[model samples]
Target: MAEAFTIRYIQPLWFIWVIIAVYIVFYAVFNHTEINVGAYWFAVITIAYILISAFVNPRDEMYASIIGMPLGILWAMYERKIDSYFEIGFLRKEIVAIVAFVILFIGRLTLSVVGFDNQLFQSVLRNIITIAFIVPLIELLKKVKIQKRFLIWLGTISYEIYIIHPFILYFFEKETTEGKQVGNLEIVLWTIGLTLLLSSVLQIVQDNLVRKVKL
Candidate 1:
């Protein structure tokens, strides 16, 4: 379980950060003229790596997220651009971007689902599909007016939730293995609720500690 988790989650996170740092350095050293160009290059390199990895080592599925990191960064950059459009009430460019994103998303998903069983290829396609989905999803989110207080709190603590949820899962598994008679649905609900509460507390503690250290 530890090995599988490391391979599936930890290694991919490390790989993505390494690639992101490399791209950041490359942009700073060579072409600080425009960030969008850097994002484009990062996207291109990520895609190229995916394709190459597909041919070279089709079994390594973790490398697929190499593309996802850049695509996420690119989406962030694009979100900034769209903010500018929103300010000026000029949505034509955003609309075009959304349409392109939809097309690429569909293509990527189709390839991922219906294409060959090659791990590398499927993983690359999945990364592309996720990347393609981010743009339009963000665009749609921009139009949404979310006003719920609980939702706002959830959003604030989301990063903590993400980090702590795995521990919750682990604890759930341990409990079940020890013959705890919790139902599956009960375990899931308890995990989620406990994760939320614990993560929020953790975040508060972290914030306070940071403040104290800064002082």
Candidate 2:
């Protein structure tokens, strides 16, 4: 929020100082309140940014591009409250998820073929894909008795898997491809195995660092 607003006041040194002074006053005033002072600051600042961007800023295009991100953040924060709202249709949820993904894949291919990059069109399509796939998948998982925490743990290391996967694949390409012929299925299994192993190691290292910080 501050970053979005900073460009306007960057050149005026006094204005920047005034913002700092206001923050100091805000903290001092809120220090006696019941809620965490930081949460108040965050909510105030985020709302300020959204209002200014939507009403004050003349660039509707920029606002259009950025509004989805904050809405997504808000949705995630209140996801548990709205889990039941995603129940969509008569079709089985897993089948619906698969069909949504296949349609999304075809849409992407069509985009590539036609080279479509209209911002508004892509933004609408992105939200449609999220609604078509993720919302249904959540409902389906509930119906199938899948543990939600399983997804939570995987989400934790998803970034690590992405980071370490390329190195793992490179090693497999170097070692396995030269020594012997391997099927695509074998290569995929090997990649997943090594990626999981390395991601777990990375998580362990982070846990240790966090523990040390607390100590």
Cα lDDT tens digits for candidate 1, 33-136: 35656566656766677677667864664365455666556555566875665556437656776777778667766765786456765665676656556555
Native-to-model Cα distance after best TM-score fit, residue 132 in candidate 1, in Å: 2.7
For candidate 2, lDDT tens digit of each residue in 14-44? Answer: 3233334443444444454433443455456
Model 2 lDDT at residue 91: 61
lDDT against the true structure, each candidate = 0.63, 0.58
Worst lDDT run of 10 residues, candidate 1, spans 9-18
TM-scores of the models, in the order given: 0.56, 0.41
lDDT leader = 1
Q: For candidate 1, what is the TM-score?
A: 0.56
Q: Compute the lDDT for candidate 2.
A: 0.58
**Model 2 segments more than 4 A misplaced:** 1-72, 87-112, 115-131, 147-159, 174-190, 204-215
